[model samples]
Target chain A: MTAPAPPSVAGARSLVEPVLRDAVARLDPLTARVAGYHLGWSDPYGRPATPGGKALRPALAILSARAAGADVGSCLPAAAAVELVHAFSLLHDDIMDGDRVRRHRPSAWTVFGRSAAMLAGDALLVLAGELLLEQGTRGGVWAARGLAAATQRLIAGQASDLEFEGRPEVSLEECRRMSADKTGSLLACSCSIGAMVAEGPAHLVAALAAFGAQAGLAFQLADDLLGIWGAPEVTGKPVLADLRARKKSLPVVAAITSGTTAGERLAKLLAQPDPLSEPELAEAARLVEEAGGRAWAEAEAEHRLDAAERQLAALDLPRGVREEFGEIIRFIASRDH
Target chain B: MTAPAPPSVAGARSLVEPVLRDAVARLDPLTARVAGYHLGWSDPYGRPATPGGKALRPALAILSARAAGADVGSCLPAAAAVELVHAFSLLHDDIMDGDRVRRHRPSAWTVFGRSAAMLAGDALLVLAGELLLEQGTRGGVWAARGLAAATQRLIAGQASDLEFEGRPEVSLEECRRMSADKTGSLLACSCSIGAMVAEGPAHLVAALAAFGAQAGLAFQLADDLLGIWGAPEVTGKPVLADLRARKKSLPVVAAITSGTTAGERLAKLLAQPDPLSEPELAEAARLVEEAGGRAWAEAEAEHRLDAAERQLAALDLPRGVREEFGEIIRFIASRDH
Candidate 1:
């Protein structure tokens, strides 16, 4: 029997090869190579690798369609488009964040250097539109518009994140706004594009969007938790990793606004030296937990997850469709890393 | 006294407003605002500015259309798209180049910051697709495919530019290829898009593309000259600024390949401590010119400009259109900045 399956990021790795096989079939050799390289489909020496990524978002797009009684065939363009945007953001974001590793390998920028990585990202973004247009979908206009708007929201969310780095007094409302714009928009875009292909009912589209947005907020909250209290073995970094970086994450913002002793201690710890000693970082994490920041965030994630599930339940889908939607919702909210 | 003549950039600037005003009326307000900001129609602070930019490329597109007997009416959408792509490239290029000013004001990133500037650029790029798709002259598939291909070529050109920046040795052939992909592709697209609208003769369309390409190559070479030797008071940078940046301009590349003593001196000068004393910098420029680098570039520019004119002259057109095209040709080749 298979060992209790690892996280879907592991299980989903197997599916990437099939997805890429389909994608590369459409591109010329050069573009396929470039696209493959950009997606971490190649090894450190740039040889083709076990094709990478969880295919998590693309799976959402396809699953949402099937769950909504729509043919997944029509949603393929949207899936590819969303995945391309995701890869574009990841490449550029690594540069901005100075992230050194991705998929247990050197980041694109680290491998090829910064500018090529940026260009590869640019190429991926441009290729998404090319893919959509090539499909000659009747809904091509809406697809382009949908993807463009989602991309803009992605930038807006990223801008807020960068901007918040310097602001010690950011509000809880501001953190929520940032998370919603950054994560929620893309998730909502996935569902909307899925429903769009189905020509699903307008109310159904609205419900899916709401459900996706809620799921996304839960995902982000969970990520913030992992960034703070997560174990090094699990997270690939020391505990209180966000604290070491002085990241103005959801928990940090919650602490600051709650006016608790832990808030004061956390802020003091953040004010200290380079990569704060692990002990110092742990002190800050303890403060965050004692001040109820963890509980607050956990409750919020639960509320949103439940809200998302409720919206999913409202849809009159067949049992098979409903079960798939339920699994995607659970995966989105609970997945680690 | 005779009226003062309009500036070339100003002459190009004048045609942009009416055309943009018409094109954006169909889009949502937020998108239109973003487009306006990118065109420098809005201030760096994001207020509306006068229709800015030398409408050089779009005017060329319209003139080419008329010469090819396409309705000027039909050319407007394509012109807007071509101009938007041009503006998008300039926005991002300024950030990557660390350029702080544009059109006598702060660059977009200087005012909007990098991510916003980047998003603003991305928005314009995407808006261009939306514009072309809506052009409806050709279907969405054709327009999107053409624009996406052009964008990839443009990004590749940019990548080559960035790649060359730190290289100690770069061939002149490499420089020309970069300039062609970077600058020539857009101009070719402008002419090709006009052809699409004009239903221009296939031979004429092909000729227009060749004319635009040669003209674009010449334009970049001339611009490179201006970057090095033109009066900063006129061009908005210090004289020999490209020399100051140690850029791999055509002249410098030619000099390096020539293997002359002065070329060696120029190369050593580029390797000199930055913040090089002004006199030493001036002496370095003299060495480059004395080595025949500047002259080599000027001759190359002349060759391409001549080829561009011959292409246009061969295009069968009404006498009035031919005369206008000639005036535009002279204007493009002779501009100082």
Candidate 2:
């Protein structure tokens, strides 16, 4: 009757939140106040606690470990670490993007001031390292190295993203590289770290990483679509927001590089110095679809999904648990918000 | 004849630079450009490499390991990590403080954009962790946890620093806590991590940390004095720069809280809405001295230096190496640049 709990929801509710709370509880009171508020765990004045994010990364970590035949309780630190890294990225990204709202509320920078948000993000990053070091017995060093490598790629991706804002001529290949580095690498790290914590065989760990990587790319493509076309009420972002900012998302890059007539018109419309009008924004979306960008992105997402499924098949996990991961990927690729 | 290599300069030159270079070399070109320039490894345009900082933290790490009876080479990774963390803090601090010049060159945030500088600092922080993970066999987990704890305290210190800028009535105890978290913690970590990497006895590691903590406090006191009185050409900072910015440095705090006639006058002059004139700045400095702030700080520095020497003597290190660390502390307390 409840539509069957999401694949990893039970484990997340029981295992992840407690570990996360324990780690965050160790922060100094001031830094903890800012972080807790930003995470939706408390109000601006730090009294009432509320539900935060979906716990997607931590759930993935826990599920991956379970699928690898490990005791889920023993891997809670690794799972919490994955969530901490994700939270760290969000806090900094909100500042970099000048985003005023996140999760339908004022962003941390708006409420806590920019310097506090910055320090809170830095604190989360350091906390991630501390969690891994505390859990260093079960492949902690390996997980720590993977997280560092992924963080390097994440920073590179963000730097490239900022650079792309100044120029609209970003190529499709460059966009793909950015997507892999920004989203795919961290997702892959999440899955691989879970397996590492489980002490799974090498082949299984590699397979899970590959699965997460492909799934991550697909998830990004879906997010790009939502950015441009999803209902503002549901997505919590204004419709055609990406176009208004002239962001060179994947579809935009694909259309510009298509060299078709529609692509040319789209590029010309986007090159103007002024902000876009509503009518012009609508036409731009049409131009992208007509230029085959929409088609190409849709097909690419499907292809990535298939590749992820194949990778999952090779992971040597129980059929039921593998199905759970497969369903999660599907949700990522197809969800409207 | 050659000043006996300053305890660990040979180890720094022979081992630390190569490791540091290799780590920075691995960053993506865009991120690497900003970081390399910030480190004084290259010009802003990525030209020939130049010399960088004094390598003080890394050298201290190596010297600590040597005093712990380990081969210096075994601890090079830890040494390089210390330098990386130091550089990370400097890059971020320059941005937060709105400082335009560093080491007589434009700061990284001014040369590149703020975002690039921020990413470069994040990159360096991540690299510090990666380097530790790579060298994880010899006390890798221990060193990683120590660095993470130190970074958390550092962030807390910076957050407190920013908070203090808004309220000028900070207490002396609050200032001391900030100084310990900001300066003493990382310096202490530099010594402890080196000992950890060397797998030194616990007593030796704890003693080195205590010595470094005391010395770090003394170093900050010396820096505060330089900020107020050292010549611009020698200190690379304008005269009374801290006073001009109304910074709550140790001496300034002491003066304001001294409850004397001169202290009352200094407070009234600083509370003005307008910036202080050059003569007002000079008068403020004289008022602080007249209130006994300068004498108090000098005595405190001497007391800390002596305590550091006693801690070093307790380490059971060979007399030569112990004296070398003592001499380094003396230099830190006396250096103008």
- In model 1, what lDDT does residue A238 have? 53
Q: Model 1 in CAPRI terms: which quality?
A: acceptable
Off by over 4 Å in 1: A1-38, A49-52, A64-77, A103-106, A194-207, A258-280, A316-319, B1-52, B61-78, B100-113, B134-141, B166-168, B194-207, B258-291, B314-325
Give all TM-scores, in the order shown.
Answer: 0.83, 0.95
lDDT of 2 by residue, A1-337 (tens): 1133474765575678878888888887778888888777888899977765677778788778877888778778888888888888888888878888787788888998877887788888888878877875747777777788888898888889988988858999999999999999898888778778767888888888888899999988988887788777766678898898888889989998998999999999999999999999999999989999888889999999999999877656765778878767777678554
**lDDT of candidate 1 over B1-337, digit per residue (tens):** 1222234324434655576667655443444455566676776455767754577777776776677666666666667777878888887788778888676666767765666566556666766776667665443345456667777778878877877887888898999998898988887766566665666666776787788788888878878878778776666777778877778888878887788999888888887667677888789778878899889888988898889878878767766765665566556666653
List chain B TM-scores, each candidate.
Answer: 0.89, 0.95
Residue B213 of candidate 1: its Cα lDDT? 85
DockQ each candidate and list the results.
0.34, 0.72
- Best candidate according to lDDT: 2
TM-score of 2: 0.95
Per-candidate interface C-alpha RMSD? 4.3, 1.2
